[model samples]
Target: MVRAGLMRIARLRVTLAYGAMLLVVTSALATLDPLARERIVEKASTNLHNLAHGHFGTLLGSAFVVDAGAIAVWLPNLLCLLALAELLWGSTRLVVAFMVGHVGATLLVAAGLIAAVKEGWTSTDITRATDVGVSYGAMAVLGAMTAALPRRWQALWIGWWIGVGAAVVATGGDFTDAGHGLALVLGALVATRFGAPEPWTRWRLGMLAVASWFGFAMVVSTTAALVPATSCGLLCALVGGLASRLSALRTRPTPSATDMVPDFERHALS
Candidate 1:
């Protein structure tokens, strides 16, 4: 019981920290140099435009366009979602899983963006109407939570994401369906692994870590130069999906007690 309380407190702290970081970043972006802010907005706008045109490459490229700028704006929302998950799954393992899943989705989007650019499938006149920060991450969070939810409730959440995506498209807004899709896939994969927590097999985890790092590196390396943004995002999504599947495969016989006991305790204790 004491251990559980400590875990809860820790999760709250982490969530708060994430929130603070987000607030700071938001303020900085709003008040920083005009040129920097303009660049950020431009990149964000370009991202949205690419998303609308099915230029997934550019959307992912947009993530890396502002260095830590995008992440600063994005990670807090993702962390908040994970905080909710922590309430159910406990702080340590669930947080790690959430982080991994979120990072995996980001990388996947980047890969897809790069791949699209390489293929010359994207248009040159990319505009900036589609840059909404962190919506994809939020969607991914909801998707991951839904995937981990009981089978009966899963469909509703899945439908919700689909509906949201459709609405974005219908309204002619800049929505990165590709990023949302990739994030969902990553979340599902992470949820599956977490749902059935297996033994900590070094080889499987190592492989996933390596793949994720490689995808991240690719995004970083290509950010400055002229590379195919859409193509890279696609690649990230592919690699992330494959890695998640591999991790899921290794984590057989899901960990029921870990997920259930915490919730049960909270309810019972309260």
Candidate 2:
């Protein structure tokens, strides 16, 4: 009975199954003719056609394509990071973090691209660019793992990720890097509800602020036709003003006992 119980527990690891499937599919794709593999990846992509057109069905399909060039590197990391996340957070939470990171980053990127197109900063043809890979999901899982670690370790891991992401964004504001940074933020945000300490850490609240700003920008930009520019500008101003007020509330110093008059002394004076 003891042996059977241990075996059952071992079998419950979702990461192994997911990793095996990833490897198998990646291997199969590698064996296919180059053109065939390319066609498959293209069809699975969540580019302008799938995202802007609301064909979200392709989102899951696109995650299966591991990007042939990145398979050796991404596959190992996925297995390790996902396995560790699953070990800490269980299967369901890991899946949620991964999906939130992958889907949220993809949508955010698509929205930004659409906004850029409307603003005429990027060529309209850029929308058709292929966007398929597993890094977003991997990075998301990796990000969530920070909340599962000890506080000291968490700081180091999260800081390293943020620093790298910022460096990447600073150097190259490409779609992939944008998606990566967004994925990390989404991962950290989503995982807070699951494993993070109570009272919410500074990083957790910071993620919320970032998310709120990003969401506001995305909604306004996407609905530029429906919302007047004046109204949108006012909305942005309101959100920024509110955020500043909240920050002030959080940062304002509280009075100490010595800084306040005793109620008894005031009553006696009156």
Candidate 3:
């Protein structure tokens, strides 16, 4: 079981590396003085000011940083979605999905904002909004994942995604919301290239890994609370172990009928 789990983890090379990179950057950011961290984060923002100045590098740089306060949530979120995409589509394809979703949507949003401001539709303060995080890329991967669902569920999932995004845009949500929405759309379009979902059984390991991670995270979070809380980490670990073992068993070559005979009977007769 342990070996199987390790092997499964090893297959997620791109996902783990990206997560580690984020962790390194975030840990370094946390060590800085609060004001210094804020300044760096502001500079990394892909907001209108940065975009207008043609600091296009922020488009790539901003994905590597997150607000100190948001690291916990965004890190896990990035891992699960991005890892699944990597597992399903391989490293190169995952990179393609992330870049398309992140860079494409960001540019689109900036263009919209530029047009909006020029037409006297909004305040200039918006240009300075902080827009650093991996969520746009995350959303793109998430949107593309719709391809993995059953057909009925796929339609429902896509509708819910787009409906929620459009609703947010209509109600005057932050420009980031629009970026997120556009990323999802772009990701879904990318999914068209991938066509049908992979086999259902192929995802068992992914579900097991995701469940174990979330369960462990939940236990850690809940245990740190004001009062005692349920710790399901043990349960999750058990489930993951069982799942890993079962997967190994299923893949083991079947014994021939002659080889299946009781060892004692076969030896005694001989």
Error of 1 at 9 (Å): 3.4
Across 1-270, the per-residue lDDT of candidate 2 in tens digits comes to 999988746744777777778888889998999899888887778898666677687788777777746566555545656655665677889899989988888888889888999999989988878888676776677677657656544554555455545444554347877787688778987888895433445654454344334323322233322234334344544554566567768988999865587988767766
Q: Which candidate gets the maximum lDDT versus the true structure? A: 3
- Candidate 1 Cα deviation (angstroms), residue 151: 2.3
Answer with 2 or 3, whichever has the higher lDDT. Answer: 3
Worst 10 residues of 2 by lDDT: 217-226
Better of 2 and 3 by TM-score: 3
Of candidates 2 and 1, the better by lDDT? 2
How do the predictions measure up, each by TM-score? 0.49, 0.68, 0.71
Give the alpha carbon lDDT tens digit for every residue of 98-207 in model 3.
88989999999989989998899988888998988876777777777777666545555555555555544455557877787788888878987875554565564576
Between candidates 1 and 2, the one scoring higher on TM-score is: 2
What does candidate 1 score on TM? Answer: 0.49
TM-score of 2: 0.68
| Whole-model Cα lDDT of every candidate shown, in order | 0.50, 0.67, 0.72
In angstroms, the error of model 1 at 112 is 3.1
Sort by TM-score, best first.
3, 2, 1
